[model samples]
Target: MPSHVWNGDDAPPNIHDVYDYIDRELKTLKTKLITKIEKQFFGGIEAIQFLIHIEEIFKSKHRIKRVKSLIPRISGWAELDLFTRTCYEVRRPGGGRDAGFTKDIQTFNAAFQRGIKSLTDLQDELKDLYCVVQTFCRNYQSLEGEFDLKWARETNLELKSAMRGIETLLEEAEEGVNIKLFSSDKFSLEVAETCDTKRYPVLRLFPDLFQKFHFSFHLIGKWRANDQIYLEDIQFKLIKTKRLQRLKHEEYNTLEIEHANLLSIIVEKRVRVKCREIRDRIKNLDQEITKLAGLKRSMMLEKSQTESDIQERKRHLFMNKNVTDIINSKDLDNILGVKKDIEILSKKLKSLNKSLKLNENDLVAKEKEKVALDTDYEDMRKSVSRSNQLAFERTELSKEISIINEKIQELEAIFYRKTDRNKLSQAFEDMKYPAGDDEE
Candidate 1:
């Protein structure tokens, strides 16, 4: 039957039949997937075709959910419902571009951890068709054992397209298994090929606790070489079904050891989980310390730079104020401005004193003449008063003589000491002076 053309649109395969038949057919195909593909030591058992149908159903229903779920690390990242072969997703809180991505990642991780129940559910989904397919493949392999290469080739040829379709679906199945795998690191590699629908290959690699192992659905396709029966992808995966049970127990112990190991390293007893968690914290500290040191060093460098700038603008303790006010200070730089003002004033005072001395000499020479002129003027004024009858002539003569006597007196006052230049210069110098010194 063409894969797309279901046995009947109206009637679906019994969920049990689907699971069992696929499981049986998977046994042979699983070997083909492993032997043909390049892979590692431990990949878990996978119901390749069953997963493909799950993906198909998922795509038919929640296409976007199915698409987005594909981003997880591997197929095993999700939980399986083996009984119904019905898959659900555990999405990261907010995986895209949002602050919620972090929260979503955490949620996804938690769901993946709870995936154990999902895997066990796979057994419940097997049924009638599973037996038919299993029997059919067994018979085909029996013929092949009898060197029926032509029949085997012709069989593969007849199912080539369907085989390819199954291969394509299997490739997309890993992510369709569950929601948690969205952010989990778990993923599948070296998946099954188109020709191998007779069997299925599943692998699960867990670094923290679970040991890696291979799953094969084959029984009849077992290759016997050198008189030794080499179970390839056929019969069973690299691991025996028996070992899986032991692995589960060991996996739990490993998980405990991992938790205790991490607890010891955490320097805190509250968190009780994987050793990987503690290692992560230690790794985080390495980053934190580096960042802290970088910031501290930067601050120190900035402080030094600021100090250098201050030094460039600093003034001597005593000269700060004066230096700030000076404009045309170049000439005055050598001579203290305060001191220079005093010196300039002293020179002016000395010049004034010399002029005073010359005035004194001139005054002495004019003193006797002024005294004689004053006596003549007084006699003329007395005559004017006695002979007022002399009228206008006498009055005019008296006024002229009085003016002459006033002029002579004015000369004496001018030549005499009025304000001493020495005293003025002394007062000016004393009023404001430079620091630390005072002098004439």
Candidate 2:
């Protein structure tokens, strides 16, 4: 709440204190303006004219909704002026935004809103870097379920990352910390034991620097003792231990490639971890799939056997037979295949013979029922014989059709022709008609 102590709770306390003072003064000014207008125009014919003249007192002097409303609105404008000025005091270098333009909390809340908007914009630009940090933060189980996602707070849908790169090079050659000896005095850094901090990242200088430039570059950051991750905070320190040569474009590329290689090594480590997990999952799935497959095969075999039994029951009548008389399945198959037609014919012939004998006796016996039965038996025998003859003819017809097909093919090949009886007769008549014409 002290003046000029801006940015407490990362906000400026001085801004608010100044706003409070300005607001009080504005309230006094409004009261004076209202009173001076009312008193000077009281009880006179020229009072209306006087009031109209006094209406030009403010930015918008037509009317005021309420004393509280008007004063507060005026106070807000004043506060905004203060807020903008305060931001100039502590504004970052090359910073385009001024503060009160953003954090106007008292009157219309313009300052707070615009500040939020700018910070949100910043978050958007750092999306990729934030994403990497988020992944790293998530890797440690301690931070897992308790993360504050800034992207959501800012409503930045694609703001997933932010990255801080640190580069340090020094020339002094030989102690573990002093790996380089330089000719010029400008850039240098020393290697040291790791520190514990949220944002420190560390890198060791490449050996090429020591061999060629007598300078080695090393980077450092705080690391978590438990998590083994580089600290979230990172800074670059170029120690001026000795003079060194400025780097060429190719050297810059080499430095960049080395940094890229370092990141790649970490990424590869993560990939290996992920791959191992995937392999384990695949193995488990394979086992489960194998188990399910075996179960499915078993159920299918049982289903097939049941269906076969049901079909067999429907196809044939199962007359009970003595165990000794019943044939085994293999023997039954052979008997039914080889001798079925002959057995059926023999049985039918015997039945016909018996019926014929009974029919012959029926007439001699002179019984009407017997005669009818005998006629019926004869009719049945004739039908059976006719059916057998028809079946035999069907076989003969099939053979004849096959033979005709072959003959048609042969005729086609030879271009064979046959005489039509009616046409032959007509031709003969034509020939006779010619002879008759000659005679006439």
Could you tell me every candidate's TM-score relative to the true structure? Answer: 0.16, 0.15
Cα lDDT of model 1 by residue, 1-440, tens digit: 43643231122233223233344444534443344321221224243443454334333323345433543223433322221122223432543532243333333344344433332232222222223333223222221242234543443343333233333333344444332221122333222332121222222222111111121122112211100121122233213333553554455455455545544544332222333454455455456545545554554455455444434334332454465565466635644553454455455545545555554455444454445545544544444343333344445545654544444344333222112344323323333343477566
- Quality of model 1 by C-alpha lDDT: 0.35
lDDT at position 59, candidate 1: 34
Output the lDDT of residue 274, model 1: 30
Q: What lDDT tens digits, residue by residue, belong to model 2 across residues 1-440?
A: 44343211221122223233333433443343234322322323243332222222221211233322423222122333343343334343342322332232222223223332333333232332232222222221111232233423332222211111101222111112222221122211221122110111101221112211211100000111111211121100011101111223334445455545544544544544655565555555556555555555554555455455544543432322223476799756654543554455445555555554554454344344444545554544454455455456555655655554544343332221112334333433443354447653
Query: Stretches of candidate 2 above 4 Å error?
Result: 1-269, 317-440
Q: On a 0 to 100 scale, what is the lDDT of residue 189 in model 1?
A: 29
Error of 1 at 10 (Å): 19
In angstroms, the error of model 2 at 323 is 22
